[model samples]
Target: MEQAFAQNLMQAAQAVEQQVDDELNRLEKLTESDIEKMRNQRLETMKQEHKKRQEWLANEKLTESDIEKMRNQRLETMKQEHKKRQEWLANGHGEYEDLPSEKELFDITKKSERIVCHFYRESTMRCKIVDKHLEALARKHIEAKFVKLSVDRAPFITERLNIKTLPTIALLIDNIVKDKIIGFTDLGNHDDFSTDVLEWRLGVGGVIDYKGDLSSPPDNNERKKKITVFGKKPKTIRNGMGGDDDDDDNDAED
Candidate 1:
């Protein structure tokens, strides 16, 4: 039994040695063509990998170019809008003007694309209130030209427009009367109306471009009414302080 076990171990050792000798002989017999084929296969694989990398890089560059194009277009549009606003400021559009004569009013209306002309009387208090709001609006809305024509100075234009009211805001486009605000009636009929209300009213006339939402209430939420005396403040009024009675009083006061 010991002799048989020793014989089996010797056979296994011989088998392993023969397998190694066979692998070494096979490697020694390799032809130049076989080695060249292996090199070519590796080179082909590297070329394929390089082509894929180049394609990915090209796609990335195209995406970056598209983004840059959009960015430049947006910048150009913003620059054009700014230039237009500056031109408007240079052409007497930013502030309110007081036209002295009917000819001046006509000339301004003809030159300006849009105009908000307030016909006022010096003696009228309500007209003074409108002046305060319009003066502020003129500075803010530079797109439209704001001007005031005193009924005393521009008598011919006043009669032609049939403006009987003390403070009538005429919205004109290319010298044609598009609309009119016949006093505080269109402006919530109150003395203490906010600038936002007046702005909304003018926006309705399409003379000025108002930024606020027309569907919503005025932006100034506080102080709907001005306190006349140190006594108790009046109740919050929505549509106007007084009814027809207040309007009659306003007419007499005007």
Candidate 2:
């Protein structure tokens, strides 16, 4: 009877140990779940804080006085820079050394058969527009070359071209004058003049109004007609020699 009682006690101990292990596993799982929840809550709180900070920054206002002060500061900075540049240029500083010379400009103009030279004054709207269009025009017509000469930068070219306008566009073929247009109007009008200049240079006669693809070769007949130089034709040898001298002599002998 005492042995059987000891056996029962061993069974009870085993059952207690199993219950303890099960409870420990459940507690650990609960602890991990709580930690995960806390981490997510912390992340959400940080996101909310960031959003609030961005909103506050967006709502922040700058008064007229603040804006005026900022503008004044910028203007002062610009003035100082302008003064420094002027001083550097006046003192023959090497910073402004690589500017294009008159001789270089002349050489470039002479080398190009179909050359488009632009003369423009400094800080002008027409000048800016011309500057922008020059490269595009050059690319569109590879046969033509585009060059920019500033009235302020190259005074000699400006004087030589006799540029009285703010933006002067000169088209030359073989160093000979083809056509010239001055000033920049509205986009519509400016495009008209640009088209006119290009068409004339390409020997397209009058302005080509059609906006079809320019990559295709122009009409052969139209090209011939436009390029043909109008002048008196040379007299034929037969006409000049009075209808073949040998035939005339044989007829006279007969």
Candidate 3:
């Protein structure tokens, strides 16, 4: 009986040791799995942060390129403006050798002779076209003097004339502005432009007579005729009535 009891106690001790060994193995597996899960989570977070940084760098590069492009464009525009200014200054500061001054312009009008003034922003294609017409008119009317002025060089004259558009023409007689026409026109349209200039000369009444053989003789009967008989007055005639009597009255008043 003593031996049997001792054997049973030994068997109980072996069973308890086996149970403790199994529990320790299960705990080791759980701890390894948890550690692996934590490592995977940390790696994923690092990848996400790296991706975000790369995207931010790409956006910053794009923004910098856009800013550089705008700066280049503005610099190019400034260069063009400077070139234009230099050209204007090189051309005698906007005054021609025989060109009349503001006071001289007024004197030309007072003399009853018509003064043709051409205002240009620059020597552009449109200005060249207008200049050709002016040369033709100078040949056609010896009594009229053709004057050229550049707006870029003569800001005071441009401002005094209230010239807002490029390639403007003004007809002055006896220092009074009789008519002004604006814009460029085809050579085919020169007849209309010439007509405006002629009308301004006629506003002087008796100061300068048309000397061209092509000019018709002035008839007192024609002078009594209505303006409708001679087609419509040009839209450029802002002031003045179209009659020799009106001119006489104005002269008398002066």
* Stretches > 4 Å off in candidate 2: 1-99, 185-254
Give the candidate number with the greatest lDDT. 1
Off by over 4 Å in 1: 1-62, 216-254
For candidate 1, the per-residue lDDT at 36 reads 93
Model 3: what TM-score? 0.37
Whole-model lDDT, candidate 1?
A: 0.73
The lDDT of each candidate is 0.73, 0.51, 0.53
**Candidates ranked by lDDT:** 1, 3, 2
| Candidates in descending TM-score order | 1, 3, 2
Candidate 1 backbone clash number: 0
Q: Could you tell me how far off, in angstroms, the CA of residue 154 lies in candidate 2 after the best superposition? A: 2.6
| Per-residue lDDT over 1-254 for candidate 3, one digit per residue giving the tens place of the 0 to 100 score | 99999999999999999999998887677777787988999999999999999999977777777988989999999999787655534432223223544454444444334566777745456666667656665554445556676666666665655666656666666555565555532112343345434433333332234543222212323444343213233233333212111111111000
- lDDT string for model 1 (45-95, tens) is 999999999999977777777989989999999999999898788779989
| RMSD to the hidden true structure, all candidates | 20.9, 25.5, 28.6
Better of 1 and 3 by TM-score: 1
